[model samples]
Target: MSLPDDTRYLKGGPVAKRIMAEVARDAAKATAEGFPPKLVSITVGDVEAVGVYVRNQRAKAEQAGIGFEERNFPADLTAAELEAAIHGMNADPRVTGIIIQRPVPRHIPIKAIQAAVHPLKDVEGMHPASIGNIVYNELDLAPCTAAASVELLKETGLDLKGLEVVVVGHSEIVGKPIAFLLMSEGATVTVCHHMTRSVAAHARRADALFVAVGKPRLIKADMVKPGAAVIDIGINTETGPDGKERIVGDVDTDSVKEVASWITPVPGGVGPITVSILLRNTMVALARQRALYQATYGTAE
Candidate 1:
């Protein structure tokens, strides 16, 4: 079967605009009530991509009227030092949300450092508590990337319930969490990894597919099911002859787009939504904290 011409390509800019508008509205409400929303991000290393991502997030936060702060450390910092930084952010009342950028120095135990961040302030939803909440089907923050993937699919007017969904990759940050979230939404979920046998066979059966294996052009046209919704979370780069690197996603966009009914492009797709979802989580955290504060101290006049 050929791809449907009505297939929609999900764009992040409009969704980001909507999120920023909501944040502005909520910030106004918070300010009128005598409180201000804030988000804090902690980075341990000098990874260029991570730095660019943090800057983008800070820009988004500022646009949404939320205070943004970046705490950076040398790449050589020890795990203990990273944990300490997270602990400090956890204790800061003004900081409603905290995200410790990933791929921290190899020496650092990321899980231990993540656990150090207060679960309530873990806006990126990498904390164990957030994962537990997700498993239990409770209303809690999810890793922004995973949540953004689901939201992007939903916004396409597709119903996930009872769909055969295949997720390629098993990283805690994206793959596994997204499969869990999809299962929660009533989709039949399959989780695959690099070692998985007949990966293409699995993908070809998917009514919906999410690829986050971080390999460029990993999913070719033959592996995709016609009319399926494909979400490409992979961002891989290769240096060109001119000594400049170009970014591309796991699926061969030109080819896959011809087979899939709906797809998300690399730079313009999940990335923007991921950052927007971070802002959304921060706003949610702020609203929850504000409600609790008012319940204890009475609403501000």
Candidate 2:
């Protein structure tokens, strides 16, 4: 979708690059200090879409100077076996973080695997404790997408304090964490779900809006407040008149850009920043491990 001339396109390239540079520096330091940050990604079965995501993550990890490993298990692997493997990674001091790729065989419970990853080594921040930390305003290890969305909102240069924010979708990982994260920043956030009687009413009053309901073009221009910053976290595939599949965000970027001051493009927006945040979480986990090491051994190494 073509962006309007007057609207600021919230491209994520610059933000991801700036974060990667810092992570690279710290990654180098962590390596030199005998605590290299290594992320172990577990994938069950052969899923084409998940493969694409795994490759992107590995490339970003390489750019950030972090070690990445992909462990592909058989589709028949049981949940207990997967959890045991995750526990093994948790015990390895060289392993800094663990990421459980989504859509495992229907037999395997994804959340159980996520919980199996140690809280300290849960780089994806899907662990219950990792998500719970956001409630206390400790955002160091928040879910990558939620953290990335908040980071993009900050890039818009809007003062978060008392900002009227409306988040559509209340999923455990994305929507709930986003509301808590924004509230911690002092923004008055209203979350909309399937039960919300008037999603548009709350959305139109928002100074900053976040949408992640997985529905394409769910937020039209009329639903947005003028000059508000819109963060589109939903990634959906839609077939156009040409009979080809295309990616579009939850907000109709082509239409909403005319009214909104800033809007995030689907492919170039939150996805890239989300990957960068994952790498950043890896470093955060490494730092926490390093600090514990220092406290125990009286030396960083």
Candidate 3:
């Protein structure tokens, strides 16, 4: 299913393009009706990686016919101060979606900050209310990373009903949500974390494996069932042969690709799809915000 050069890649490029095209159409429609979708990214620190991610979202938003803005706050800013800023955005009629970048100052609680973003504008889907919706199979507003992983599995033509899925992380953001989403689709799910005894043992049983534990090369070929679909959601930086930096997933691609039926390359796989989903969520938020606006003003656009 792939060239020898790319290794049965479940590449996100094609999938993301298709999804973005739909987002663009909806975005255009929203704008034509006078409610242009707008996304706001809040960062409380100068994290380099977070900066790159925000910029990428900005570019993607522009391409999708959505308006985007980023607000950077000093690391020394108090939690209350940041929450106040979020409150301001929450009340803004033009802001359709809100995302709080991670790695905020240690004193600031991310959960509380994310909670401050109105659920209607929580485009990243990190708010407790937004994530809770997944329990009821409400995926339209599910977390972007988890949604991307599910989409990647679909590319393999794997039947979600009664399929075996192993997720090797337990974090609230990526791991837990992906497992819940898989279950909603009727996949039998197993979640393994740092505390999970013999992580490889659990992973070996999966018809589809999702790895997002952040450890590099944590899932190897020996741990994957033959012909299984593998989705590596981990992004790790490592130095390669020339001593330059390279990004890789949790799975050992060279080894896993030999045995797996389909695999996603770290940089080009789930990452693109996640960003696209964020934009798509923005469009959803746009519609929801428009409803609220219309109800308040007695005007339909």
Backbone clash tally for model 1?
0
Candidates 2 and 3 compared by lDDT, better number: 2
RMSD (Cα, Å) of model 3: 2.5
Q: Model 1: clashing residue pairs?
A: none
lDDT of 2 at 104: 87
> Is candidate 1 or 3 superior in lDDT?
3
Clashes found in each candidate (C-alpha, N, C closer than 3 A): 0, 0, 0
Report, for every candidate in turn, its global Cα lDDT versus the true structure. 0.84, 0.91, 0.89
Tens digits of per-residue lDDT, candidate 3, 1-301, equal 2335434789999999999999999999888988888988888877686878888889999999999888889889999999999999999988898888888889998888889999999999888998898887887888899889888999988789999999999999899999999899999999999998898899898999999989999988999998889999999999999999999889999889988888998889998899999998888788877777779887555
Kindly report which residue stretches of model 3 are placed more than 4 angstroms away from their true locations once superposed.
1-7, 45-49, 293-301
Best model number under lDDT:
2
Worst 10 residues of 2 by lDDT: 292-301
lDDT score of residue 103 within candidate 3 = 82
Candidate 3: residue 161 Cα off by (Å): 0.7
How far off is model 1, as Cα RMSD? 3.2
Tens digits of per-residue lDDT for model 1 on 1-301? 3335767787677777787788788887886777787887777777676877778888888888888888888989988877777777777778898877777888998788888888778788888988988998864479988988888777777788899999999999799899888888899999999899899999999988999998899999999998889999999998867899988899898898888889988778888887888888887787777777678799567
Total clashes in model 2, counting residue pairs 3 or more apart in sequence or in different chains: 0
Per-candidate TM-score against the hidden true structure: 0.89, 0.96, 0.93
Better of 1 and 2 by TM-score: 2
